[model samples]
Target: MATSFIVVLLFIALVGYTRLAEAVSENPTASQIRFLLDEDAALRQKLHTRIQGLRQSVSTLNASIVPCSCPLPTTPAPRTQVSYTGTLKSTMSSLNAASVFNFTGDLINVGAPYTPHDAHFVAPVSGIYGFSLAAYMSPRYYVYIDLLKENAPILHVKTGHYYSGSTNRQVNLGTNFVLTNMTKGDHVWAKYSGGSAYLFGEGVSTFSGFLLYEL
Candidate 1:
């Protein structure tokens, strides 16, 4: 009987020990190291989430606006008005034998020396002005005439009516082609087509004027 009782007591002690071990394994505080590791993992996750939010906020702030180095340049507006470019023929007198129609179409006598002359002009307004001249020819005489800019001859049209015919009557002398190269205060005039060609106008005068243009 005593032997049987001792064996039963030993078996009961072993079963109690096994139950205690299982309870200890389920209890988090029993292994303080494992409990701290879980807390550390949670802290790391929170820190990572905060950092990601901060980074996203910083990126959002950077994308809020655009930057530039310098401002755009301004341009000036154009002026509106007619600007004169041709030589101004000045004469207070009428076209006579001496002046020989030494005048512009408006009766302004483009006076004397009968050489190339520059006209003083002001840009009436900012614009590109064209200048041109018309040369009338006489059929009876061989005439050599030219248009000049600042005394530099540009146009030269001559007729050999005298050499080709003997009539004192006016023949197909010639007329000037169109010229538009003009600028404000750019003097324009005409001269003797400097040569042996003996050519003269009906009024014994030549002329030049400005032609202003715009699109």
Candidate 2:
């Protein structure tokens, strides 16, 4: 801004000097020359005072500005991912009531929540979870399986038996899923509820669960 003001002042001074030179060349009068010089000096003094005022205004504006005092935006921490998958490796026949089916083969345990040693998935954090239980039975035999949470039944599934007089005794698969909320240290597992038959394993039965979201 100051540079532009100086350029405009120089242009005005040049025009005034050119007009004064033309007047002196035409009239050749000392009084007229002195009057033009005085007018030019007054105009220059007025412009210089205006420029000083503009500089003082710019300095005051710069001093009055304040930097932002508010805090910067923050990033949230990442969420914990919890999930597990296990399968029964051996078949169990003639199972007693409330028998817990241990899935010793652990395929995926992301947060180490599921313990295949005790067939229990202990929750590591409070959240909503989705559990799935699948069971396969031998031909001509069926069993009722229950998905339990801390020894209480939450979901039940049963395999179908082979029909009578059928040449082939076809095996049936039983599967069920339950969505439940669990707190930290809560237990979840599968149990054989009641049936004449038992659970068929050898990778045919599975138990899996995953945390949908945290509370």
Candidate 3:
């Protein structure tokens, strides 16, 4: 009976040993579990580094981009302004019949629209213009000058004896501020009235004009 009992106890011990060996094989070792945790931690750090690098690249690109907020330069328009001033150098006396006065001296002739040869101002462009003239006479002489546009007169200026009796007096007659609208190629000149008329020169007699604005 003692031998049989000892044999049964040995069989129970062998069965328990087999079950413990299977449990150890089915579960993992401590070293394997630690290695798996370390590998997982390294992968998470790499993923975090890649995400930070992408964020930095996006920030750098945004900083390098330039904003289009500054205003651009604009071109200016063209300007057109023409002017002329002329005078006579010598005296004009005894004008027989109505005739155009010729200006021989020039102070300012911009654009060369006024010519001494033609003694007229031809319009270079269509615009409103302002013209002026000053005439000087000595003693009891009478003078009549007209601002002529084409063949007809537009403005008249006359200087006569302001005082009665024969007195030696010098007088200045001026046609100031005659504004007229002129087209291109139109002519403007000064005409002297017929008969005995005298005009003093030496820059005292002047003719000036300017283009006010374009049409």
Candidate 4:
């Protein structure tokens, strides 16, 4: 009886040992779980650091490209303009003497630079200018004129008598354009050169000038 009881005790101990081995093989150890948690925390930290570095780089690039505090440019206003036109009121005749033609009538005058009493245009500002003149005379009479800038002739118009077999013949002479650069306070006018010429005082004689552009 003693021998049989000892054998049964040995068999029970062997079965308990086999069940403990199977449990250990199927489930993870405490140390292994702790190691996996530590690895996951390290990966998250690395990803967060990379994201912060990228954000800093983008902020630096934006600061370099954008302006901080500069004012915008503004456009300038248009320049001022001056112009004048006048005509003769009566006949002017001279022999062996040169005289400035007096345009006693004003067709249009802007900026008040031209006066009928002076018979000239004074530039108010430095710029490019255009001038024109027209003159007429009776039959058998000649016409000679010059456009003068500060006492110097820039253009001239002269017409000789046309023999049309009639003493009552008339002639017209003119300069359509005289473009020149002028400074401020420059004086411009038309003068009749000395000769046996009659500048018809009638409205047929005209003088005009205008500022083309500012310098």
Whole-model alpha-carbon lDDT for candidate 1: 0.45
lDDT of 2 by residue, 1-215 (tens): 77788789878888987887886887678888788878888888978888888899899999999999999999987898998988888988879865667776858999988886787899999999999999888666878888889889998888857554855445489888999999989999887777765788889799999999998
Taking the tens digit of each residue's C-alpha lDDT, what string does model 3 give over 174-200? 555589999988899888863246777
Kindly list the per-residue Cα lDDT of model 4 for residues 141-196, writing each as its tens digit.
77778889999998787654655466544455555579999999999888778435
TM-score of each: 0.37, 0.73, 0.61, 0.61
Candidate topping lDDT: 2
lDDT of each: 0.45, 0.84, 0.74, 0.73
Candidate 1 local lDDT, 1-215, one digit each (tens): 43454456556555654555555566537465465555556655755665667677778988996898687987866534442222224322222212222333333322221222333223232345444444443444455556565666666666534553653534453545544454444554445543334434344333434334433
Off by over 4 Å in 1: 1-59, 62-64, 76-103, 106-131, 165-173, 176-186, 193-215
Better of 1 and 3 by lDDT: 3
Top model number, TM-score: 2
Better lDDT candidate (2, 3): 2
The clash count for each model shown is: 6, 0, 0, 3
Q: How far is candidate 4 from the true structure (C-alpha RMSD, Å)?
A: 18.8
Instruction: Give every collision pair in model 1.
Output: 130-211, 139-170, 139-171, 140-170, 140-171, 143-199
Question: Per-residue lDDT for 158 in model 2?
Answer: 83
After best superposition, candidate 3 residue 34: deviation in angstroms? Answer: 7.9
